[model samples]
Target chain A: GAGVSQSPRYKVAKRGQDVALRCDPISGHVSLFWYQQALGQGPEFLTYFQNEAQLDKSGLPSDRFFAERPEGSVSTLKIQRTQQEDSAVYLCASSLRTRVEQFFGPGTRLTVL
Target chain B: GESVGLHLPTLSVQEGDNSIINCAYSNSASDYFIWYKQESGKGPQFIIDIRSNMDKRQGQRVTVLLNKTVKHLSLQIAATQPGDSAVYFCAEKSPGGGATNKLIFGTGTLLAVQP
Candidate 1:
C-alpha cells in the first residue's frame, strides 16, 4: 500500500512569496497531520485533521500559515508571505481511525531565501 | 511546557551489536509513547509504540520500554545493521484520548552503525 505522499520534494522561494505544499494521505485514512522540522531538530506539530474537519490548528506558528482538507482525502498547507524563518521541511502524516500510529510521507523541503 | 528529550545527541555502535537509545519526557500524564526512525531527507517512520498501561512492547527487531515512575523511555534494537543508521526520535501523545492528538517529539538521537 502506498504511504502518504507529498509533492515538490524540494522548493525554493523568495521571501514574501506564497507557497503551497500538498499531501495525499493513504486511501482510507481518517486522520491527517502536518508538522514542521527545523535543521538538526525534531518535527513539531503544525495541525491535524479528522476526515474533512480541521480539528487542531493551534500548532500553526503564525497567521500566514493555513491548511485545509476538503473531501476528506487530500490536504494542503499554504504559507503566505514566506519568511526565512519558514525555511524548513514540512511533513505530512496519516493514520487509521482506530490507531495512534501515524504513517508519514517523504515531506517537502521548502527553502525561503 | 511539556516536552520530550533525548539523553544523547548521537550514538555510535558496531554492526550486529545491540543498541539502546534513551529518552526523558516531562509530562507524567502522557499515556502513549512512540519511536520513530528518520533518514536524511525523509520524514519520520514509525518503529514501535507503547501505551502507558504497559511497560514494554516489541516489534520485529526493535523493542520499546516505558517507565512511568521515572518518566523515561528506551528503544532497544537487536543486532544493529548499517541500515539502522539514522536519526531516532521519541514522541509522546498529549495527555488525552482520541487518535487525533498532536505528538510532542524529542530532539532526536543519531544512530551511527559502524561495520
Candidate 2:
C-alpha cells in the first residue's frame, strides 16, 4: 500500500477478552510507533520499534499491553483482559526515518464493554 | 469540544481569515518538531514540521514558526476554511535522533472556523 494500513477500523471487545490489532507500515519504512488516544485526548505514546527491535515500552499503561514487530514491516498490539478504560483509538505510524515526518494509519477504534 | 490536558490552546477564526495555533514544549533538548491535524474518529494527518536549527518552515497555505528562546512553536494557516476545522497537535522528537523515535506531543487544539 502507498500508506500505512491498519486492520479492523472498529473493534468491539467484551471486558476480559483479548484483542489484537495489526498494522502494516509503508514498505521499507524503518521506524514504527504505537499510540493510544482516548476520547477528547491527544494520542499518547505506547511503544516504539526500530525495525524488529523494541527500544521503548515505557509508555505502555499496563503489563497486559504487548506489542511486537517481528519483521520490522508489520506489527501487532495485543491487549489481554481488556478493561473499559482501555477503550480508545489505537494508532500506528511509520516514518521513512525517525525525526522526519511520520505517516499515520487510519487507526483502530477499540471499544470495550 | 472537550479539551485534552496536553492539548494546545485553541484558536477560532472566521472563514477566509487566518488561523494560528501555538505550543509550548517542556523539553528543550528536543531537536525535531512537527504538527499534525486530526479529524474526529481518525488518526492524525501530517501537517508541517520544523527542525530546531531553523526558526521557520513553510508548506502550502501553512507555515511553522519556532522560537528556541521561549521553547514555543506555532502553526499558521492562511485563508482558513471549513475543511481546516479539526484538532491540531504539536509533537517533539528529541536529540536521540534517527529512525529510533518517540514524539512527545501536546494535547491538541480544536480550530473552529466560523463561516
Candidate 3:
C-alpha cells in the first residue's frame, strides 16, 4: 500500500484505562502528524514529528497524551487514564516534506466507555 | 485565537448540479491552502490546493478560489455526483509554525449529493 496505515481500526476502552494507537506512515516520508477528529468536526492537530524528532506538540489536549516515533518510520499515540472526552477518531498523515501536501490514513476510532 | 471556519454546516445538491463550499481564515500570513474531502469512515483526501499568491486553481471537476483580501476560500464542484457526497474541509498552513507548516482545519461542510 502506498498510503499511510493505522491500527487498530476501532478501539473501545473503559474509562481510566490506558490505550495505545499505532500509525505507519508512507515509506521515506519525512514528516508525520497526528490529529483528533470528533463527530461532525474537522480533524484537529495533535502533534508532529520530523523523523525521530518531535518538533511540535502544541495541540495535545492534555499531559496525559503522549506520542513517540523512536525509529522515525512508525509512530504511536498513547493516552493514559483515558476519559470519555478522549474518544475520537485518531488520524495520521505523512508528507514527503514539511509544509507540503500530506496523505492521511483511515484513522483509528477510539471509544472510551 | 485565529482559526479556520466554514460558512455552511451542510449542503444538499441534486446530481448533475454544481456544488460550492466556502471557508474563511483569520491568518493573513498563511501562504498555502488546501481542500480535503472525507467520506464516511474514511480519512480526508486532498482535493485541491492554492497558494496565497494565486487567486484560483483548478483540478478535474473542482476549482479553488482564494480571496486574500477577504481571507476567504471556496471550492466548486462541477456536475456533482453520488461519489461526491462527503464532508469537505479547508485548511491553511500557518506561516509561523516553522518548517513543519502546521495546517489548521476548518469546520467541514457535509455535501449530500442526491439523485
Model 1, position B81, has a per-residue lDDT of 100
What is the lDDT of every predicted structure here?
Answer: 0.94, 0.86, 0.94
Give one digit per residue, the lDDT tens place, for model 2 in B1-115: 1111333466788999998898887666777888999998777999998989999999999999998898888899999999999999988874553445677667889999999
Task: Calculate DockQ per candidate and list them.
Answer: 0.85, 0.75, 0.84
TM agreement with the true structure for every prediction: 0.97, 0.92, 0.98
Q: Report how far off residue A82 is in candidate 3 (Å).
A: 0.5
User: What lDDT tens digits, residue by residue, belong to model 1 across residues A1-113?
Assistant: 88899998999999999999999999999999999999999999999999999988888999999999989999999999999999999999999877888899999999999
Model 3 misplaced regions, further than 4 Å: none
Pairs of residues clashing in candidate 2: A98-B99, B6-B107, B7-B107, B7-B108, B8-B108
Candidate 3 chain A least-lDDT 10 residues: A94-103
Comparing 2 with 3 on DockQ, the higher-scoring candidate is: 3
Listed per model in order, the count of residue pairs whose N, CA or C atoms clash below 3 Å is 0, 5, 0
Candidate 2 reaches a DockQ of: 0.75
TM-score of chain B of each: 0.95, 0.88, 0.97
Q: Which residue runs of candidate 2 sit more than 4 Å off their true CA positions?
A: B1-8, B95-99
Higher-DockQ candidate of 1 and 2: 1
Candidate 3 chain B, run of 10 with poorest lDDT: B93-102
Q: Top lDDT: which candidate number?
A: 1
